[model samples]
Target chain A: MEALVALSIAVLTASGVWLLLRPRTFQVIIGLSLLSYAVNLFIFSMGRLRSNAAPLLEKGVQADPAALADPLPQALVLTAIVISFATTALFLVVLLAARGLSGTDHVDGGEGRQ
Target chain B: MSFLADHLIITPILLPLLAGAAMLLVNDRHYRLRAALGLVSTLALLVIAIMLVQLADVPAGDASLGRAYLLGNWPIPVAIVLVVDRLSALMLTLSAVLALCMQIYALARWHRAGLHFHSLVQFLLMGLNGAFLTGDLFNLFVFFEVLLAASYSLVLHGAGQQRVEAGLKYIAINLAASLLFLIGVSMIYGVTGTLNMADLAMRLPDIAAADRPLLEVGAAILAVAFLVKAAIWPLGLWLPNTYGAASAPVAAMFVIMSKVGIYAVLRVWMLVFGPHAGASAYFGGDWLLYAGLATVTVAAIAVLATQDSKQLAGHSLLVSSGTLLAAIGTGQAGVVGAALFYLISSSLGIGAFYLLIELTERNKTAGADILAVTWEAFGEADDVLPGEEEVGVAIPATMALLGISFILCALLIAGLPPVSGFIAKFALLTAAFNPEGLGATGEPISTTGWLLLAALLLSGLTALIALARAGMKIFWMPASTRVPRVRLIEMAPIGTLLILCMVLTVQAGPVLRYTQAAAEELFAPESYVESVFGAPRAGELPQEAEL
Candidate 1:
């Protein structure tokens, strides 16, 4: 289970990093978004891999308590996803403003892009 | 019924956050209302700060666990924890006061710059207060981004060619630094499996020594991000140019930006590394010492070469930061204590100094008044009269008063005796030379003595050179004759900051001593951990955080 989750993380992160190297502001923003998703998923999976098991501990169920996934990492991942979404939106607005004010969205042209 | 004890944890963070939200409700573009609101909120923060400072003077010096109501009683390291120790509380107070001053200063200077100034400044306060109080690594990052986003707008408040150009560079570098910060936190999380700082402090010491190289790398990278933010050494070149063009209040407010980095370095290093293996195994702090020394020497030279008012003040800040960093690198309990003391004084001193610089810059006195003064002071002052005094409002046309203020500002920053600048430096130098404490950078008493002596002497020389250049041109030399009038609103914040600085110096015995104690708290945070997360769970998380 760890191996499968690790493989998925590896693939997603690789793709995201590749996209991040793109030249345009739009592409860079997209890459950042993708990377954020990959990170959120990767962190969530770190609490020990669980397959087909519900995260919640059920009442009186004969379950391997040792196999239960850690809830902390799951919560952390949820928070990160929300924050990244806000950041991405803010970045988008900044990008649009930069393009409007300076006639370009590239990092080099305008001194105003945040 | 006991509001201070019960609500202390979240009050500093909540006040500015809620105020910023409520501010949006009042969209009156009138400067008077905006200015009043800004001042009232600032005064509220000042009250919060003083109350917290009083609490720190108690036996604890900082609260342990459960001082205030935790949100929903989830407890620390599980739900968000807001713990205010002596150091964090003091920083919140000082940063808030300076921020408030900047807002007042801005109201007078940029009457047409729009309502964003008040909102952004208030939000920035939220970020500053939050960073000081947060116990989680991710929360620190969250607060940092919040402040930086607001700063991006403030830095480019005018959107002029210079401001925009500077803002662009500032944003790009900071964004990259933010990314580095994220990556570092992620790496630590990947290793330790938790984000709670107190938890990480406990767990870090337990990590096997042989496989701990990754921890160093992660710690260093995180340190670098903060260092970049603080504008230390190679990473700080972008600061002077960015600051040179900002409006006075905006520039003055940046005094806190450097403190944020210094706080992070000191916080993480003292809390995570001192008790753990990082300090001893990595450079034995020799590199930190050298970096601090280099930053000081280089910055002094740069300040000497600078011509502009804001730019000169910028160099002085770098020098102060370098001094503080060097003291931290010494790693002695005494040195850290002194460094903490210096941090408080310098943070306020630089803020006040920056406002002074802005106040003067705005006052562009006409060449006529400058020449008249030059002639009056030095009996026609050599053969350098290249311009004539113009016939205008004789009492300085509003702008000349600002220039006069600049001379005072330069004197204050230069560390001449009687001003707070001198008092601030005296404390730092005394700390560096203390015979029994973090005493003498591991060298013989005499050898270390000379090094301290040299640093003190050089700082004095730097001040004198800067004064001669600024004074001769500004007060003694003929002005260019066509100066712009500086506003009264601009001078108010600068004056307030300077007066506060004077008060800090006079009461140095208590303030400096408190900072020293706070530094000790930072260096040995066993109590900090217990105060953050309950003693029971304190041992559970952060080892992976040092990853």
Candidate 2:
């Protein structure tokens, strides 16, 4: 399971980097989004490939104490995703505003014209 | 209600977060109201930090409260915990004080470039406070983003053409850095099975020997993200440009931002990597030291070449960061203390330069000189100053104050006597030559000793030759055009900040001792572990920083 997820993250991150090399700012934002998603999955998978049981323990239920997934990375990934989302939005708007003001999506927003 | 006191770790972060949300309701551009709200909020944060410090003094849990409060009492390694101790508390206080001063110093620009400056400023503080207080690495990243996003908008707040251009690169570089940051965090977690820093600290020691290389690789990658943010060495190519182009007050506030990275390096190296950090071949502490020294050298040369006052100050900040990182790499308490003290002095020093840039706009000589620094540093093809009339309408009081500020900052950066800069360098020099670390590490004493000495001598000479040369042109060269009247609103904050720096210089003794205490607190993981884990169980492993 960890291998499968890690492979997916590798693919996503690779594609994200390719997209980030694009000429325009908006595409870069998209690239950042893809990268963030890859990272979230990767961090979530850090619980060492646990399965066969949820983390929550139910009353009167008998289960392997060691089988439950480590819950800490989940919390970490969850917080990271939310924060990344907010920052992505913030960057997208800033990019749009810069484009509108300067009439360029190229970084250095005023590149070549100045 | 007393539980509120135990949960004090959250208050410093929560205070500004709550205030930022409330600031959207404030429609008017009244600087007084904004200043009052920010000041009150920051003062509260300062008080909370003091409380945390006092708590650190007390033995852990001989009382009713736990040092690290698990959110909702979910237990260690599961719930997010906010840990507070001497190091974090001191950093919180420093960031708060700097933010408060920057907010007040920004009043003139507030009305001039209004768009909820108060809200953004408060939110920036919230991020800074959160970054310092978070006991989890992922949460640290979260706060780092919060800090950057607010900073992004503020950089371009004045909406000038240069700001727009410079801010683009700033945003782009930071976005890339953040991607790198995410990758690093994921890699660390993937091997460690946890992201809580305290939990990771505990588990790291038990990782399989064969897997340790991956851990160090993950750590090195993470270290790069911080180095980027800290503007260390070649990674810092984006910094001077972005900072030089940013508005004065925003630039001043930004001086603290890189320090966050240095603090992170210290925190992670000590906690996560353990005391014998990078003892393995893969993660070399010596490399960090070499890189740090290189950064200092490059930045100093860059500053010498830079003619723009803002860029010069910006390069100086980069150099200051190098000093701190080098100290951390040195692994001596006294060196770290010097680095930490420099943090305070340089943060304030840069603020005065930013103000100088604003106040001296009308002085073509100074403005041209300021622009020169950027041109040289960026390797821009142009050396030609714009037409004489393009000089800003300079203010006289602003000019004198800024001139004094530049000299003082130069003196400080140079490690000249009677200034905090001298004290900062002194501490580092003492540490490098100290017999404890040199003998224990079995490292050559002469190399580190001579390096520190040469750096000290060169910095002094740089101040004498370059800064004095520039100061002569700006202050004594006589402005061809008179500056406008400096406003009381502007002068008040600048005076106050400068005055505070002077006080810090005078109180250098106590400050150095506090920094030592902070470093000791940083190094001793048992204090942190005990705070978070309650008591060590028999045969329980010592805590490790999350890989």
Best by TM-score: 2
User: Which candidate achieves the best lDDT against the true structure?
Assistant: 2
**For every candidate, how close is chain A to the native chain A in TM-score?**
0.79, 0.85
Q: What is the lDDT of residue B25 in candidate 1?
A: 77
Q: How many pairs collide in each candidate, listed in order?
A: 13, 16
Tens digits of per-residue lDDT for model 1 on A1-114? Answer: 677777877787777677667656676677677777777766676455677655677765666767677776677677677767776776676566656656776654544644
Tens digits of per-residue lDDT for model 2, B346-368:
77777766766565553454345
Candidate 2 Cα misplacement greater than 4 A, ranges: A1-7, A48-59, A65-75, A110-114, B1-4, B29-32, B57-66, B276-283, B365-399, B437-444, B535-547
Model 1 chain A lDDT-worst window of ten: A105-114
Model 1 stretches astray by more than 4 angstroms: A1-55, A59-65, A104-106, A110-114, B28-31, B61-69, B276-284, B363-408, B435-443, B446-460, B482-484, B533-547
- The best candidate by DockQ is 2
Error of 1 at B74 (Å): 1.1
How does chain B of model 1 score on TM-score? Answer: 0.85
